[model samples]
Structure formats: structure tokens, C-alpha cells
Target: MKITEKTNEGLKREYGIVVPNEDIATKVAVKLEEIATKVSLPGFRPGKAPKDLIKKKYEEAVSSEVAEEEINKAVDQIIKEKSLKPAYRPDINVESYKFGTDLSFELSLEVIPEIEIKPFDNITLDKFVVEISDKEIDERIEFFANRQKEYKNSDSQGPVKTGDVVLIDFVGSTGGVEFKGGKGEDYDLEIGSNSFIPGFEDQLVGAKVGDIVDVNVDFPKEYHAKDLAGKPALFKVTVKAIREAVKVEINDEFAKKFGQESLESLKKMVRESISHDYEMSSKMALKKRLLDALSNEYDFEVPSKLKEMEFGAIWKQIEDAKAKGQLDEEDKDKSDEELKAEYQDIAERRVRLGILMAEIGEANQIKVEQKDLNKAIFEEASRYRGYEQQVIEQYTKNPRLIEGLKAPIFEEKVVDFIISKVKLNESKVSKEEALKKEEEANEPAKKKAAPKKKTKAKKEEE
Candidate 1:
């Protein structure tokens, strides 16, 4: 057996391998001997079959299997001896192979780039801290209270208004012919909710009870129902009743409805919820800043294969969005080439950051504990509500799915480890301010021309 380096470029290696014909024949004979022990022939008992007979009957199949095994063994040995960490599976092309000839093949692969761990102490980042305020808690309480609001028939007979729930019977038609799912009886629709077609709710805003009205609306161009998309329809509606909403008073009974002992306890719970939200948001912003800083600090050659994979995934998403008419606002005006160029850079940056973060985590011996993984699994299961146990079972049954859960846990742990070593300049900011800063940070960068520097003569003239 022999191996020779065919190509050695940035993070890429290609090798030419040769396996002697005698080695392949030896493997084939061993396989045939093993098969002869289990397989019975017409005249000979299982293990007593003649070697020539077995070779004549199974040589082709056994030789092919032996060749594959020998190739894998050779590749594995090369990888071990070379200490090569491939980014993805190596591509092997069998150049030539014959029954009585040396097998030759080409193995090509992109290896993981050698990343250098940088000192984190020199990295400075702003850690925006937001304190949960009384007003925020009050607003949250009001939100929950609003959800528990009750409605009653309006005492005054008047037209329906915003926030009023109207019960009506309607039949919708396009081109004077009614279609399936175009009729509803005793449907309760809240005015101004925008739950119906774009113009449907607005047309019903001033409709009075006992009034029969023809409401006209055009289905949106991208309506989910293909037949109705971009089509105008008329709904003949009879308003039956109008109900006005009444907010639920925050009291002991209200608190009990939510499984709390008292109003104060409910407020405390609300405050804690808000505080958790703020904390999570702050940490997310800090992580983003940390990643950006790290990406800027390190400039190394990332494996092109990994970048292509990342770019392929991102491009697929863009194409899917375009197909669904859900292209992002920022991308709407850009040409396909322009969007591709922009997202290609994003993909490269992501690959670079991912490699750097993994290196840092490895260098520092950071790990996600079993308890942390269990907690993550539990949290993921909780998202399914009543099917929590089933979700947990699904994850437990599938190791691959468990790895999906482990990836984020591992990344977050790495982020937290980096955060611990870096200098975080904590500054208290209002919740709104913190959120606004995050929004601004996430906005796509726009190119601006640099102002021309003033010469000394120009400065003197000015």
C-alpha cells in the first residue's frame, strides 16, 4: 500500500492511493472462506465446499466488497497517520481497479482550518443592562387583564365600532357566483381586528344591527387561497347583535383565575416574567456584540468548502422566500446577483465565526453538562405543551435529534465562557433604549461615501 500527496492547498488536501493486487486477493479469499462456512451447496456440506467452487460462484461479489473495505481501511490509516480533520466526508474517485491489478484512487477533501485562540481579556464589549420597571409590570398586568375581559350585549342601539364584537350572517361571492367556504352563519367578528380580508373588517365598522349591508373587499395578491387571490368579492351580511367589551378588574378573584393567591402575588409574577425577558434580551445582544467583535479581531482563511455549504443553505432560504412572495423588505429592491453577493459575505462571516467560536471553546475545555442538556431537552419539550412527554420520547429515541438540541446548548455555553473572560462594560439603560439599540445593531449596513479630508490649504481657506 502507498499514498502520495496530489494536492496541498489552503485547508484542502488530495491524495493518490495504491493498494496491491495481492492484498485485495487475500481479503477476497478470507471473505469467501467466511461465506463458505455458512452457505450450503447442492453437493457439498456448508464448511466442506471446495475453495475453487466457492471462488467461482462468489468471486465477483466478494472481490467488490473486499475492494471497498480495503479502500476504507487505507483511507482511515492515511487520515490517522496524517492527523487530518476533514470538514466533510472525503470524496474518493476510483481511478482504476481490476481483478489482478493494483487498485488506484484519488481522495480529495477540505480539512478544518487551524484556528488560533485569541486572548479574550483584550476584547471589550458593551453589555446593555435593562431593569424591569413598575410601569412595565403594570402594563403586563393590564395585558393579562385584557385577555380576561368579558363582553355583553350593548345597551344602546347603535352602529358597531372598533373593539366591538359583532355577530352576523354572511354569504360571500365572486363574479355573482358563491364559492365553497364563502358563507358563514352567526359568525362573531371583532371590528378593527383585521382577522378577515384586508377591507372586510373596515367595511363592517359602521354597520348597525338589523342592517343588511353588502361589504366589498379584495383578497390580497398573496392570499393563501389560490382561487380567491387578487380577486374582489362582495359579502351580503346581516348584522344580528353588537357586544361591547368590559375590562376585568384586577382583584383577588382575578388573581385566583390565573392560579395566584393575590393581586400582589400576580404583580410579583409579572415583574419576574418581565425581568426574565429583559435579561434574556440583554444576553442575546451581548452575544451578538461579542461575535461581531471576535469576527473583526480575527482574519484567517476559512475553508472554501464550508463557506460554500453555508452559502448554499442561505441561498436556498432566499429562493424559498422569493417563491412564497415573502422576500424581506431590504432584499425586495435588490437584484438576484446583488442579494447573492451580499448574503455570500454573510455566509463567509458565519462560517468564520462558527470555526473561531468552536476553537475557543475547545481551547478553554468548555463543555455542556448532562444536566444542562437535560434542561434544554425539557425546555424544548415544554414548547409542545400537552405533548411534552411524547416530544421527550422522540428526542430520546433519536440520537440525531438529541444532537440538534445539543448544538445550541454547546454554542451558548461557549458564548457564556467567552463572556466570562471578556471585559463587559455594564451600563443600565431603559428597556426601550436597550431594545432600540439592538434593532439598530441588527439593521443591514448601508454604504456611505467617506467625506474628503481637508488639505492644509483648504483648512486655511476655510
Candidate 2:
């Protein structure tokens, strides 16, 4: 057996590995001998088959097994000897092979880059603190009560009000030709919900029960249905009924309807739920800002293999977005070269953050403990309400999903650890202010419009 370095570049390596025929023959003979002890041929007694006959009959099968073992062993030996850690699985392409000749292959791999993690104490991060207010709790209680509100039929119905949900049947036609999705029976539409065409519901105002009226409107240019967009149409609408929402009273009885024993209990629950949500949001926002800061502070060359893998993932998402005509308007304006550059930056940031977070976790001994994982799993399962056990089973059985869950947990633990070590300047801010900062961090900077292309970009490229 022999190994030779064919190429050595920045993190990229290529090698040639050769396993002599004698080595393969030895392995095959050994395998055949093992099989001879437990196997028989049609004309031979068990364990009595001649070695030459066994070789003749099982040489192909034995050779295949031997080749696989030899290749694996050769690669492992070479990697171990060179002290090389691949950033990804090595690509092996068989170069040449023969029954009586050496087995040779070319190995291509990207080595993991050495990471010199910066000191944690040197990293600076801010933790946003939001003070829970009673006023906020009252506002949330009101919102929760609104969800339990009911509707009652209006008796003094002279004209339909903006807040009323009107039930109506209508047919739309342009020049006496009806279109699809322009007609319905007993459709309950909230007048102010903007669920229908801009003027569709307004036209039903002053319309009484069983009143048939002709409403004319034009669909917007951006209407989802291409055929009716921007076309003027007359809808023959028949008002079936008029109804209004009946706001629920913020009383004990109303609170009891929400599974709470009393209004006081409901208010307490709402306050705690709101506080918990705000706290979680604050922590998440701070963590994201910290991650961004870390990215800004550290500029390291990520392994090419990792970058390609991450880019492949991001590119797939880009292609999916393009398929749905969901490409970012800002990105669409850029040139192909410009978009590539931007996406490459995005790929780098992802890889950088991944490496940094993983290293931080390792440095601090942060881990997803069984208890924490079980709690997370239970919380996730509780989302389904009654089928928690099923959800838990589903989560535990799928290793990939478990890893996905572990990522956020690991990132959070790392972030918390960093926060403890760093000089955190805690600044108390309103929830709105924290949210504003979060939005600003996520918002992309405005750029000049892209020049028109001679030809439309390929769907995937776009």
C-alpha cells in the first residue's frame, strides 16, 4: 500500500492512494477462507470446498468487499498519518483497478481551518432590559378579552356600518361575462377587514336583507387573478343578512369562559403570559444583536467546504423564493455579479456565526442537557395541546429534528455564557424601543436601483 500527495492548496487537498494487488488478494483469500467454514457448493460438502474452487467461484464477491475495505483503510491511514481533518466527507474517484493489479483512487478533500477563538472577556455585548408595566398588562388583558367577543344581529339596520360583518351572495361580470372566484353564496365578510376588493364591501352599505343591488368596481392591477385585474365589473349582490360583533364584557363571567375561574385569575394569567413573552423577545433580540456584533468583530476565512455547503443551502432557498416570485425587490435590482457578491457575503456570515457559536459553546462547556432538552421537547409538544406524547415521540425518534432543536439551545447557552463573561451595559428600554432596534438591525440598507438587464436573468440566478 502507498499514498502520495498529489496537490496541496489552501485547505484543499488531493491525494493518490494505491493498494497493491497482493494486499487485496490476501484480504480476499482471508474472506474466502472464512466463508469456506460456513458454506458449501453444489458438488462439495460443507467446509470441504477446495480453496482454488472457492476462489474461482467467489472471487468477484470477495474482491468487491476487499476493495471497499482497502479503500476505506487506505484513506483512514492516509488521513491519520497526515493529521488532516476534513471539513467534509472526502470525494473518492477510482482511478484504475484490475483483478491482478493495484487498486488506485484519487481523493479530494477540504481540510478544516484552524480557528483561533478570541478571548470571551474581550467580547462586549449589551443586554436589553424591558420593564413590565401594569398598563401593558391591562392592554394585553383587553386584547385577550376581545378574542372572546361575540356577534349579534343588528335590529336598527338602516345602513351597514364599517365594523359589521355582512353576509351576502354576489356575482361579478365584465360586459356580461362572469369570472371565476367572483361569485359566492352566503359569504360572511367583515366590512373593515379588507378581505374583499377595496370597494366590494362598501357598496353593500344601506343594503337591507334580500335587497338586490348592482355594485360596480375595478379590480386592482395587482390582483392575483390576472383575467379580472384592472377590469371594471358589475357585481349583482344580494344581501342575505346584516350582523355586528358583540364585544364581550371584561367581567368575571367573561373571564370564566376563557377557562379561568374568575376575572382576577384571568388578569393574572394575562399579565404573566405577557411578561414572559416580552422577556423572551428581549433576550432573543439582544442575542441577535450580539451575534451581529460578533460577526462584525471577527473576520476569518471559513473553510471552503463549509462555505459551499452553506451556500448550497442558501442558494436552494433563493431558488425556492424565485420560483414563487418572492425574490427580494432590492436583490432583484442588482446585477448578477452584485447579487452573487451579496449572497456570498450572507453565506460567509452564516458560516462565521456557526463556527463562533460552536467554539463559544465548546470553550464554556455549554451543552444541551437531558433535562433542558426534555423541557424543550415537552414545551414544543405542548403546542399541540392534547397530543404531547405523540409530538415528543416524533421529536425523539428524528435525530435531525433533535439536532435542529439543539442548535437554538446551544446558541442560547453560548450567548448566555458570553453575556456573563462580557461587560454587559444593561440599558432599560421600553418593549417598543427594543423591537425598533431589532427591526433596524434586520433591515437591509437601501441601495440604488439595478440597471435593466439585456435579457431576463435565469430563474435560479435571479
Instruction: List TM-scores for all candidates, in order.
Output: 0.87, 0.80
Q: Write model 1 residue lDDT over 392-411, tens digit each, in one string.
A: 89988998987777767888
What's the C-alpha lDDT at position 22 in model 1? 95
What does candidate 2's lDDT look like per residue over 40-125, in tens digits? Answer: 88888999999888889889988988898888887898789989977778899998887788999988998766677777677666
In each prediction, how many residue pairs overlap at the backbone (N, C-alpha, C within less than 3 A)? Answer: 0, 1
lDDT of all predictions, in order shown?
Answer: 0.81, 0.76
Angstrom error of the Cα, residue 221, model 2: value is: 15
| Candidate 2: Cα lDDT at 208 | 74
What TM-score does structure 2 among the candidates reach? 0.80
Task: Determine which window of 10 residues in candidate 2 has minimal summed lDDT.
Answer: 445-454
